[model samples]
Target: MVPPAVESPNPQLTQQFLSSALSQRGPSALPYSEDTKWLIRHHLLSLTTSFPSLEPKTATFTHNDGRSVNLLQSDGTVPMPYQGVTYNIPVVIWLMESYPRHPPCVYVNPTRDMVIKRPHSHVNPSGLVSLPYLHNWIYPSSNLVDLVRALSLTFAADPPLFSQRRAPRTPPSHNPNPNPSPNFDSFSSGSSNPGAFSSGYSRPSIPPNNYPPSPYASGSGRVQPSPTTTTSHHGEDQSEVFKRNAINKLVEIVHGDVVGLRKTREGEMEGLFSVQGVLKQREDQLNKGLKGMRDEMEGLEQQLQMVLMNSDVIEGWLRDNQGKKFRSLENVEDAFECVDVLSKQMLDCTASDLAIEDTLYALDKAVQVGSVPFDQYLRSVRALSREQFFHRAMVAKVRAAQLQAQVANMASRNQHYAV
Candidate 1:
């Protein structure tokens, strides 16, 4: 069927609608991030600008997982060239939550009179479209306009839908009444039912010129019957017609309410999911902090144990020296003996190094005051420096031995604690 021609949408209104739908805070707001929303707006505008036949709008999308989300949708027809003739093929493009990162979902939105062509590689019976471009979609590069163009080309090669043939109606029997009034059947047949159309709008299989121009042809691209063409049934009971109309109105109201409720619930779910993500991040941070605190506590405990052990050793040495009394400075020096032979050697080397440093300082002072000659001063300094170097080397070796001994002692302490 030849799709209805769509008029160019008002730029200001289009922008306004997109802004409202993609607002950060609102019931109608999309789930896209701020940057993504801007990209979506730009992509939609670009598409409509390039192909005026396509119109952007918002709709509810239901996933296979039974989750409902409000998403931006482009519902309209794209121009496809088939066998030297251009035809408009209706389509719907759904921008998912992770759009641009992920490709948009395209579908062949066929009208009620049309049926999907089976065994098609690009299109499935459920109207879901699969194309090479979608498979290799790259972010910030692939866009809605290019996707629509690809769809047009692919559809041109093999159309996704074909018109469903209907059997011809038999001619009505002749009535005896000279003034024949329209019955219920005649009234209903002529009346336009909105439900008769699907996939947004309907298109005639024959040339558009053969039928009357659609009331919405120059407007929103939707097909609506003209008011003038709507005729009242004179023969049918007015009360019965009113009852039927009232029931239909009630049903529509109920349907609208249900849709609104679903959308509200879906919005709540999205909010909850966002809160959950925040909570998960905080939980991870807390866990990391707790582990760090535990490590710090263990280090402090180890330091306290080492300090206590040194205190115990000092107390034992004090007790051991409690009975000893020194009569002279030499005896005091002998009383405070080194803990081991290596410790005594380290102490002797340290003292000799300090003595040499003092001797060098005295020689400098004597030379400055002319008490010592320059040559003598130089010779004395050289001799003192050589002796000091040997003492420092011995001190370094002793310190290395002490460090290794301390490391061994700590390892033993750790092993004891483990036992």
Candidate 2:
């Protein structure tokens, strides 16, 4: 027994869906691995959100041939430019299973007419790889609609960040001899010569110095800087990028350390002043004690001499009158106590002198080390500031380019309808 007849799948319908998905909304979200869809979808969504004015509408056109063509599903139609001239914009977003880990192939339309600026071309637009500004295209957790919107907006807006060219520089003329001070706009490098720089900008060599200057003490010649190397506004020959980075780093480091030292210095001053005051008091006390001890010692010597003389006289009397010998013994004991008091005063003075010297030494050491800590900390902070500055500039450039493109597209479209 044979089985009943079954209907066959319509090839035209399949083609239409595939074409619509590719041209209108980009690749199917279902066919793609979850990771691929998420990554691509997020980038597209962010691009669209940036421009609220534009909306996408679908249309279909079938040719005289039996083959029915849908703008999105069939061979994609070139979008009509704002001037009503047809500009072919063919973009394809396809994914591999190893995406994010491996970048997807993103075909940008209108490649022949599309002139992207330098530097930005180095980036991968998919945002899966670590390209400089590619991450701007992506957002977190997106859908297919999001990706289509991003692509549409991205094409509509041609931001200068993505276009790095500076007025499409012309190469130097090959017919003329290379000379110093070549004009940036018009220069001759002989017809056969390639551009000096990759961007085709003319960088002239330094002219020979007609007037020789005297040598300095270091025996270095007074060489004038080449105009080609020097910045137009500044005599410095450093690249703008390097200069910016250095400046940023320095500012950051200096500001941080200055603030820290201000706080630290206040605390340190209080302790130092207190220690200084104690030291001064000890010095004054030692001086006063020494003076008093000297006076007492001299008086004791004089008194002893008087006593000795008296004793001699009294001895003669004692022989005659025994009363004076007992009085002499008491006088000798009083003189010994006075000497003991003078010895203790001398020991105290020496101890005070040692304490003051130790304190002074410690304070000097602290001052020496504390002087440079703030400066060192400042230098470190400056380094960080420089890094931050560069990152900010890079991000800003990409954003600016994106905005420029969007504006340009809008203007073109508005002009188209005006006609």
Candidate 3:
């Protein structure tokens, strides 16, 4: 007899196993971030605590893109409650590299004696499971425990597997006849050879009584025999039996083809979803770049406006003084006359300060070249700096007075407008 696939929960063992798998380095390392690995370990531990049947292990998972990754897998059975009794349904859950953010891949791992029920709402012919919980998986909130619970609940409503029925064995007759008449039973059973049953499809080692009652069984809790087993050449025409067998074979072929096509389509769809996620990330980046460009364009437009205003002021000044000719330096100074006494004082102070600065620079250069003695250069610099200080102080005072005057003028204009 095969050992039960599920075992009791062992949190300490589970943790140790996960730690060992996750800590592997280099080529054998799990392809998960440090934080993700931690989360995976925690999630598995918690899941095992809740459901002792599911055990964590590592497996190589190949994606639709043909890339193989060593991912953490949880394989065992989940206890599903049906008709007042609980049944263990074998399943394998693969945690993808992008788990938490994306849902894990789940498949119904039926045993040799079990066959996946066709037209199953949640499980596909290829054993892939689709659940609303997986579809609505939310990161940070969804966990392995909850997912397993959902699977159990969904499967309890509609079980995914049914026990495969084997060909019935014929009972030996004790009647001592010299020769046995040929019949449909003898031909169907191939009774000439005692090992014919073993040569044919191998049946489950477990007795029929040990098998769970199939969910597809009728009200009497007995599975209805197939048409081939119930109908015989003795009761039905031989031509009809051959035709039925041919039709069944054709149906099986078509079902297999359909299942293959469906699996291919599902793989293509998964690839498309991955591409869509990549496209969504790129779209977010493009949107951010476009926003930055828009902000930069606005700043540039503002600068351009300021430049245009400054250009207009310079152009107006050039137009106003284009024909005015200065006869001497004094006339040139007069042409750029200040508007007020404070403005005139600021202009004079600024010009005197600049002149003193030039004299100091010349003295420094003269000292550097040894044209002027260091003592004389120092004395001249001291005197010029004293004078420059007074000029700069005067410039500051005049500028402050001018600013105050402008404030008063603006206030008076506002008062007049109010009146």
Candidate 4:
């Protein structure tokens, strides 16, 4: 099955545009790819949105020769000034089979007479408009809507009919030379002309291309177009595009500033958080130290309390028993007489006990050392002990008296307790 030759975005006008396109474009029109069809539909849709005067429809016309062709174009009316006069001009953008790879072609279809000459740099007598941007087109980066906007700006600068050519500059004449050397032609052979030798070589003539400076060229051969002629091929340049680029750059700068400010604030917050953490740690350590010190202080206080209690008890004991007196009965002289007798008896008893213990120890030692027989030594010790025992009994009676006198003296003094 043969695919439809024309794809109309606006289905209502499809039949009418099909007839028109068949008549205008040839029978050999190529079938559009899916992408090309989509771009055309999109271009038409955008034209309608931007230019209310657009008649968005696809058209094809079948000629009498039994041939059908498709014209891929979207027509619109745009307000423009020509020769200092404003008029809404009818325009059309045609998409070829090789679109996207090839730039879209434009035509300024005037409603008026065909013979009327319009002074436009890019729009010639045939109504073909050449755009510099289209000449420098790169697909995906360049869109139909942008192309339309560029058209708008191109019209805003000196539009087609208003831009006229200035007078052509005439070349300066260097024809008549009064002092012509006849032998100048002979200068081709350096040694042939004597007159050519007398006169130095004549200055070289300047080329016509160099004499008349091309509008695009300066002293340097670089093609530098004026700002007004940036789109001279399309009769005007796009100042709006430059302005838009500048605005976008400014927005980027502001965004960068905002990002920098956020980073600075985050850094400051981080610093503050670190400081707070350090301070909290220090506080915890100080509190722990304070708790330990308080515990130590409490222990010291308890020790002091115990010491004070002990001291108080000692002081009370001293206060109660430091000085005291005892009341006793009579018979003091008798007690003194008894004490002297008893003391003399105690001294005699102690001496007898010592002599008995010494004799026993000496006899035991002599027997142990083999100086005497064990039986003889024992008999000698027994005799001495019996004599000592008699003396000890007498001494015991004297000691009992002496103890009684000591008790009397202690009662009189009364050092620790009251009597």
Per-prediction TM-score, please? 0.43, 0.20, 0.43, 0.30
- In candidate 3, stretches whose alpha carbon ends up further than 4 angstroms from where it belongs are 1-7, 169-419
Query: lDDT values of the candidates?
Result: 0.74, 0.40, 0.73, 0.55
Superior candidate under TM-score, 1 versus 4: 1
Q: In candidate 4, what are the lDDT values of residues 68-118, reduced to their tens digit?
A: 656466676554433333344457777666675578777776432111134
> Per-residue error at 345 for model 4, in Å?
99
lDDT of 1 by residue, 284-329 (tens): 9999999999999999986786677678879999998788768766
Report residue 70 deviation for candidate 2 (angstroms).
77
Off by over 4 Å in 1: 26-28, 168-419
TM-score of 2: 0.20
Query: Which is the better candidate, 1 or 2, if ranked by TM-score?
Result: 1
| Rank list by lDDT | 1, 3, 4, 2
